[model samples]
Target: MVTALRGVSERAEAWLDVERERIGLWLPVALGAGIAAWFALPAMIQWIGLLFLLAAGALVGVLAGWQRRLGRIAAVGSAVMAAGLLLIWARASWVAAPVLAQPAVTAFSAEVEAVEPQPAREQVRLIVRPLRRPDLPPRVRLTLRGDGDGIAPGAFVGLRARLMPPPTASLPGGYDFAQRAWFDRIGAVGTVLGDVVRSPGARRGSQPLRARLSAHIHAQVAGSPGGIAAALVTGDRGAISPEDDEAMRRAGLAHLLSISGLHVTAVIGFAMLVAMRLFALSRRLALAGYVLPIAAAAGALAGAGYTWLAGAEVPTLRSLIAALLVLVAFLMGREALTLRLVAAGALIVLLWRPESLAGPSFQLSFAAVTAIVALHESPMMRRFLARRDEALPLRWGRALAGLLITGLVVELALAPIALFHFHKAGLYGALANVVAIPLTTFVIMPMEAAGLLFDSVGLGTPFWWVADHALRLLIALAHAVADTPGAVATMPSFPRWGFALTVGGGLWILIWRTRWRWAGAVPLAIGIAALLAQPRPDLLITGDGRNIAAAVPGGGYALLRNRAGDFVRDTMSEAAGIDAPLGALADLDHVECNADFCRWRQGAEEGVTRAGQGIARGEQDAAARVILASRGRDRIEGAEMAAACAAADVVISDRWLPRECAGRWLTIDRDSLAQSGGLAIYFGERPRVVAALRAGDEHPWRQPDQLSGNDEAVPTDALAP
Candidate 1:
């Protein structure tokens, strides 16, 4: 029994050791990345302070390293880094307060630096270089009408027009454009003015060698291969139709289009292979190794435009770094890849730009690498690989299986994050990836390379055919998968706890060699369950002429009111969990009133007599149990209505009250409200509240005919009390 216990104890100790090492390695990387993101902070002071902290920490670490206690020194260093990162984050949030506090502006002037057309929506994401201001940054995004002028990618123009924050409804669980822009150093946002004035500074100067190369490749495939070449080589999809984009997404080939890890790996692998073959005649391993690195550098330069266009996102960077490391290792005659390469790459990126740790690309990229490494080292995968030394057919079969397995594993690993951040899962992602990966690698990439080569020779016809064929194939694949039923599964957004649980579980599954991997399922299940258990709101009110919404519940009815089309559309769509028609509420029960008294009645429900002026006297006793008014309502009338519905709930309009109102009033402006009373919520802001009302909550107030003498409307004075 003692011997058996000792064996178990040893295993546990080993596991703990691995966990600690993983944390030590990853934590520093996360901290570093987080720090780098400080540049995106709106305030300068915070950035300066963070810079100071980081500098101080590094100095301390170096000083401490002079002593023999290396581990202690490292710990201190990590703590300093973490503290600096936290301070930076805090400062950024402090600066962001004012931005969020201010109401969104509609009209503004901005300089357009780049325009990416989204043909499906007839829109374009205008990357604007904002004019310097005392308070804000110098960049922003303006998603405006896409009138295809065959606008070049880097054209600069002055734009002036309305700009509003993104509607909450349009993107449920996807990227927050506002937050993303903020992180990308974007300031104020707005659309084009009348017509974009082509700025004198708009023209790009004489292009660099890489830029010229990209332009040449683009020109060759522009008319023929179009979207496919754009995606494969340049990572530019502004020219791609929405249909094609959606199809690619559905087919799981979306990664290929993005010029992510797969593309980088392919470039490196191809370069290495070509180098090896060319140097085979020389019979010199060193020469072959050197050639591969040079080839990789060339490939990297060739794909520079794509990398930059994709924002040189963390995952792409990781792949590039890994590839470079592999070449270096080969040049040194190292037979095996090391985790240190990945660690070093991560450390370098983190040191340069720490804020990347919070990004999905960073997480996904690192997760994929970690998964690959862990799996490759696992007994199961090694055993299988060792036995599979077959010819082309067998190799192909193994490769296919590996692809499928990797896709499934990565998808599963990223499931929680996707559900939390995107609020949806691509059900057909694995299947889509299977088709898209090879097509992109074997077909699209080669065509792009050939096109570039042909363009260099001033013969564009062959390249055009390749581009055309690739685009057609890509578009068809994306459309077929995207259109399939249940291709996307929508879920409620999960909280941080759920995300933590899910991520932890996923890591366990990937890393744990023992049966403890099954334990990971617990957190994953919890995350999914939490998302599924989210409650629906009772009432939803769209902001009047603004991109805001509110959910209200009182009496027997839930009221959803909004004047803005975008707000209304978003609220209804989110609340209903469907693509609600734009004008669906036009004929539904609605209350129309100016700044004064608003009347509420169901458009569909009959016998609801429309009361006029006398109704203001509170004689009939049947106005909504709550009288919701907008801002700037005449005080005398508002007081009267409040008094009339004193026994009932009087929810003042958010607009009517000061920017900061007392918590009791069923606040109705842009903010959200929770439903409590026995009210079948008709509102659509908070889903959970609506779900509660659906579970049967009778309204507090009933008509005089239905009520007894003991129950009469409460006085308005009682509302405040």
Candidate 2:
């Protein structure tokens, strides 16, 4: 046994020596791990967190004194990770802006900071800084009337509106907009109550330019194609119809519309290509040793401009920083699109906007690039893509193969993240992207650029027409693919632990450079299995406590609501993987349901399995009774309420119980549920609960008190954070 262990250690050392270059790539991973660690914690005392970081620094100092090669690597790697974790924690504290605690109606005078006009809807989104509310954060997002004319950035305006805290997750593991809002310093979000009384000069800020450009593009193009074009150029996505957007998402082409890394890379690449070509035309300039530098400078400038044009959102800014790093790498004569560049960009972005680390854009962007770089660096791929004077047909075949490989790699690399955030993954996204990417990158983008060039001479109509047609073709293809049966697969639930496992496995595989990398597949397999293993919740409650979904005795889930809008239905469907329409609670077979309560009968069928598993053998013949209440009524007679409580498993009313009501196993009332934002309850031997807002969570944006308000409508587009 001692000899075998020694042999293994020797072999590992040899492998490490051979793969020394790859070790540097893990530094960024360490940093990201640190940042992720910070976000993972619910709440930490500031001084305690700082002390932990200091301890980490001390660990690094002590570890660095070790003489062993492996010890050195561990010290450096762990130090990077600790730095990342502490850096993110510090950033959070630094940017801890004020957030509204609850929904409140008030009239306040404000200055228009920015105006985002939705030409399609003939409405506008006003970013304002309220003058009267000194306690409010610097910015608030409000939906208002009109085409957003007459309000400049500096123009003061007065308005009466009801402000609400940014929306939290509607269900456990659902989207959380409050986090993003907090990072953006948006104190409150709401719709303008009535007419806006403004000083009314002219709407200023970056929006006016972007809105005009978007409108111009829409005019040149038409329909959804025009919307796509405008989004591609100006990053104004409001013009795209919901149907088209859904199709894009289903087809896995939604990335194109987001003005992210791909668009930034393309713009920078094109700018560099143009500058290099112009310089190459002059032999003297090419020989002066300034050609590459000039080209890099041009690419950097274009990337920055494009980022600003795209609203300068964190995602766009992340891409810009990454692209700039690539340019810098090129100027320094290093490999431009390598893993190091990706890491550097990620580090810079994390330092600038640590909160973005939690967002899908940041995760997907970095993961995809890191995986792609690793793949291309492999010996087999390097040999495959090696340049040679080959036949045109062979070259085309090689390019096609590379594209397919890249798409599949990116798909696999990003699948866990996509599944974690969206609960869904595209089935044929690689196949669809094989066609869409080339069109967008080679044909559509170039045509759009040419149109802008020709428009300088007032002759760009034909180019714009060509670009519009190409965009339409892309949309048509997306629809065809999205509408196909089984184009998308959704998981009913995915726990954060599963996501962590998969991500760690992926990083292990990407960062290692030996047969040992294959070992990552073990955890990857386990994580994927875990994703499909989470039990579907038996009950779901909206944040407002106004709606409820309960699994029936038979098979299907039923809802208790006067009207379940498309948004609510879709949100529930996505979260639970219930494709069938939600049935009326009172209509389910063998279940006793009324306006105030529901009871799921035991053994309604031979056996009802969930997620392919049955309940525990802890025997019980009693039915599961879930009591619900309404808005108008809070309490009932003491004896009647006591009997109702005694007969069931849990009570989900808004805590309107009488004094004698005491027999229920558990009571989840409005105020208690409010602290959680929302929740999912799994009916079992002992009901398991998952809160949308985890316990001890004390993020700046979180105000659990705000989640308990009454008269809350089912959240929809109008109330979007």
Candidate 3:
């Protein structure tokens, strides 16, 4: 055993000796891990062991300085990890804002922070700051049911609005908007009740500029083409029809609409190229060694300006930072693109907004960039993918091949994240990107830029006309690709554990430069297996307790009611991994549903039960039935709830059931739904629930959690309830 252990140690040291160069690349990864750790905590505490860890890390770092190789690496990693935790803790504290406790209707004058004008509907969304109540939160989002005329960012307006705490997930395994709202410092979200009373104020901000530019683009190009152009240029996507947006998503070209790395790179690269060329025209400037830095500065300035115009959203800001880093590296006479640069970008983003670590934007963007950089860093891939001087046809073929390969690589890298967030992954993104990337890079963007430039001179019509036609081709391409068979792979939910394993394994593969990196395939394969084997929920309930969906024996879901809006249906569909509409419960086989309730007979015979966690196989047969009460609280009585609860294996209710009413296995009602946020019911010999929000969840923005834990509840209790 000793001999074997020594041999292993020697081998590890050898591997470390060779792979040590890659250590620096993982600093940002360490930081991100810390940020993720902060978010994973159920509740905040006094530094959450930050001080001890920091001190311990410092001690290790100091000792490691006295040692060599592996010790030094551990020291650096530990130190940075601790620093990352500190940075996030500080960020969270700095951005922490009061959360709205209950619903309220009050008239108040407030300064508008942002405005999103939707042409499709009369309603407009605005983020505002209430001027008066010391008890009120600083920021609230209001959706006014009107044309929202004469209201712009920086305008002060007095109006009566119904304000409530931001919503949690609409259903289990769905996005949590409240967490995002917390970071954005938006405490309340509601609708305006009365007409707006606009007050005069200087309207100057990115929204005004973005609104005007977006409107101008919309005027120049009509319909979907104009919508796409406007979104690309100004990041105002209200103009894009839902049909076209969905097509873009399905085609895997939706990134075009978001001002991300590609757009940022294009703007900066073009600016740099132009600046360099202009500087080269002056021989004195070129000879004075000022060309590269000056061009880089110009590129950075242009990128910053574009980012500002794009609303400085997380993704745009991240891309701009990464681009600036590249420019900085280039001017310093170092390799511009590297994993270290990706790390720096990630570190900056995390430090700026620690909560962004939980968001798809940060994860997806950073993951994509990291994978791309690692690919380029590999000597084998570099040799294989390197562009060479050759015949024009050969060069074009190689370039196309490279684009396809990069797209495939990025697609694979992002698949887990996509699945975790959206319950689906685009399968044909690589094939679509092969055409879309160049189309956006060479044709559409140039024409659009020219159109914008010429619009100022009042001669942009022809350019916009050309852009419109080119966009038509792009949209057509997106539709054709989206309609292709097996365009996307779907699953109901990729569990957090599986997602962690996959991302961890992927990072291992990407970060390590040694052949041992192949070991990551083991965890990656295991995570994929877990994702595939994950059991589907037999039933799902919306947060509001108004809608319920049960799994059909064969496939898809049976809805208790069809009157639910598209949003609810869509949310359920995504969570159920069914791309089509959910059918009515009454239409399903062996199911009886009425105005009051729906009963479905399903169990072992129909493979409704899994082996573990719930009722085991063969424990029950098709004779078993699950019932859900369809009536609202005011309409349903306690006796009826008890009877339904007793008659079924699982009981779900739209009304609040008395404490005495408990089903055979599980009973869920409006009261429980309020506590759980939403629920995923798994029917088996022993039915179980997966809740979006857990009991005692004390996150500040999780409604009554923070309020109930303090005296804050008194006012909220008296005011709204």
Candidate 4:
């Protein structure tokens, strides 16, 4: 036993050492110290201390590197730098924490910055430049309410709104949006107070340069032939429509819609080619060496495109910096595709805004770049491509292969986080990218550029025709792809550990160039295994206070109460994976609304007896059993009825009552049934269930343990008597 214990200790120590080497143990320690300082020190002192610490640490790092023998010194400096970063982050959090904690209330004076209007619903986000509350955070984003022409992006308007945090819902075993929003720095979210009142200030500054440019481009390409033209140039989705979006996602062409690494690279590459060709014809121009610089400037402009001035969003800026770095390297006569450029871009972004490290855009962009660069340098890919000549067919094949390889690597890298954030995977994304990326990059971008030049030169007719045709083609492609079956899969949610494992493994595979680095797949496999091991919920109920739906697997369901709305029924149907005819439940001998007992009889062999007018029950004698009720019921009066249904494993009610009943009791009330703005519960024989109930349980179906603890009559309001 002693020998085994020693071996375990050694292994643990070695593992810790490895992690320390990779992440520098001092970073976490420093972060912890910074967190501590935020609570302990004054705000001004904290900021001063953090600034000094950063300067001192950076000096130490420089000195240590110069000495070459000061390993410990470098590590200590790194830790200090890490701690300083933490302090800065904590300080920001401190300033914002109070405003975030306050309940969202009506703020009449707010400025609308952006509007995303859908066919069914429109979202207008505003920058709440607080004039009355000067000490409050300067910029608070609020969503306004109203329909029609008054609201536009970049408009300052007077609107009232009671902002709340984003709403959360549990979809079986799935990701939680509320938690994701917290990490994303969204302090509060809520609906509009009333009809948005547009003051005279609304018209002023409504069309900023970027907004005007986006609008103009959108309008110019509105009648374009394909979806590709609009997506390639301006990142405009207004002309694409929902059907087109769905199609692109289905066919794996969805990445083209988002301005990412592929689009940037294509723009840069095209500019470089054009510049070199222009210079090749003139020796004097070549001698002056204006080609690289011109190309670099053009690439930067292309990256900036029409979406540059959206308040310096980290992801877009990061991509632009990376593209600029590549251009600079080319101008300096160095290999532009090195990982060092990637690292430089990362470091620069991290220094500017550390919070972006946690965002999806940063993760996805870097992951794709790292994968493509690594694969390009791989012996296998190189040897395989070398065998094919540089013909058009071969080039197209190479592009397709590159797209697939990069897409697969990025998907694997981002899958865990995507699932954690959205709870859905774009299964067809691999195929979509191969077809969509090439079409957008090679065909659409150049055409859009031509159209813009022509429009500028007063030859607008031809350019407009080309743009229209391109958009239509792109839309058609997206539609065709999306219409196919099984385009995406809803994944069960996995915790943070799964994300860490997946990302760590993916990074190892994509970034590490060593031969034996394939072992990274171990963690990747473990993460998937962990996700697959997650437990499934046995029963689900969905409603909006008007209707209540109870569903089981294999399309079996019992409705306790049917009201005016079918929203609950639709939600339940999706949750239960029911695709059969909706009216089939009526033919299954289920009970209809009656005067006395709400009941159902299954065939001739089975009989279900429910108590009270609103109480409902369904039982499968040889299999599972259940009891359901309407809005108000505590305990049934008839002893014979209780005894007759004594074998039931679970009893469910729309509301709770003060009564001692057999088996486990579930309730649907404000504290019991979630569908009615109440808590829901699942009671069983397990001790864990009892402990869970005691843990300040917030489900709508379970009564608060505090209420049950008192011997005095439960409040009439608390129980349905």
Best of the candidates, TM-score: 3
In the order shown, the candidates' Cα RMSDs to the true structure are: 13.3, 5.1, 4.8, 10.5
TM-score of 3: 0.91
What's the TM-score of each model vs. the native?
A: 0.68, 0.89, 0.91, 0.68
Q: How much lDDT does each candidate structure score?
A: 0.52, 0.75, 0.78, 0.51
Best by lDDT: 3
* Deviation from native of the Cα of residue 327 in model 1, angstroms: 2.5
Whichever of 3 and 4 has more lDDT, that candidate is 3
Error of 2 at 629 (Å): 5.5
Which regions in candidate 1 have their CA more than 4 angstroms from the true location? 1-25, 28-137, 140-159, 163-175, 198-225, 279-311, 333-343, 387-395, 512-521, 538-583, 586-665, 670-721
- Ordered by TM-score, highest first, the candidates read 3, 2, 4, 1
On residues 286-378, what C-alpha lDDT tens digit does candidate 1 reach at each position? 555555556656555644544665557676777777766766676678844555566677776665545566567677667667676777767
lDDT of 3 by residue, 52-134 (tens): 67668767767745365666666777777777777776775677788777777776667788899766555689999876555
Candidate 4 has a TM-score of 0.68
Per-residue lDDT of model 4, residues 1-721, tens digit only: 9999768756645544444433332343244334334322434555567657756666776765533324344546546655645644553454332224334455445455455432222444455443344323344556554343535665555545566443444343322344334434444565666665555523544545544555556656553333345455545454455546656654656666676666667766776677678766887767887766776776677566633643345555666777888878877888888666666776666556554454566666666676677677678877766656678988878867866876786666555665554555566676666666666666667777776777777776676676566556766766666666776554434645776677667666665555435777999888878776643233444322223344333435444554423545544444433422233222344443333223332221232432233433333333333443334343446463454234434444434323443434333333443433312223223311111112332221122111111112212122110
- Collision count for each candidate, in order: 49, 7, 2, 38
- Two-way lDDT contest, 2 vs 3, winner: 3
> Candidate 2 overall Cα lDDT vs. reference?
0.75
- lDDT of candidate 2 over 1-721, digit per residue (tens): 9999778767867887887877777776777777777677777774357446746765765665445446567667667776777787677667666777778776666778777766566678889987635545567899887766656566667677788888888998898988888667787898888766654353433336777778778888877888889888889887787888989998989988988888988999999999999998888888898888998899999988988988887668878887887777777778877777777777777777777789998888788878888899889999998888999999999989998998899988987888888888777788999999989999998999889888879999999988988998999999999999898887777877778889889888988878989888888888999998877787888777777776655456777773788788777776776555788766656566655555554344324443136654232333344444443354467777777667655666655455566545666666777787677877766668778888877665664222222233221222111
Ranking by lDDT: 3, 2, 1, 4
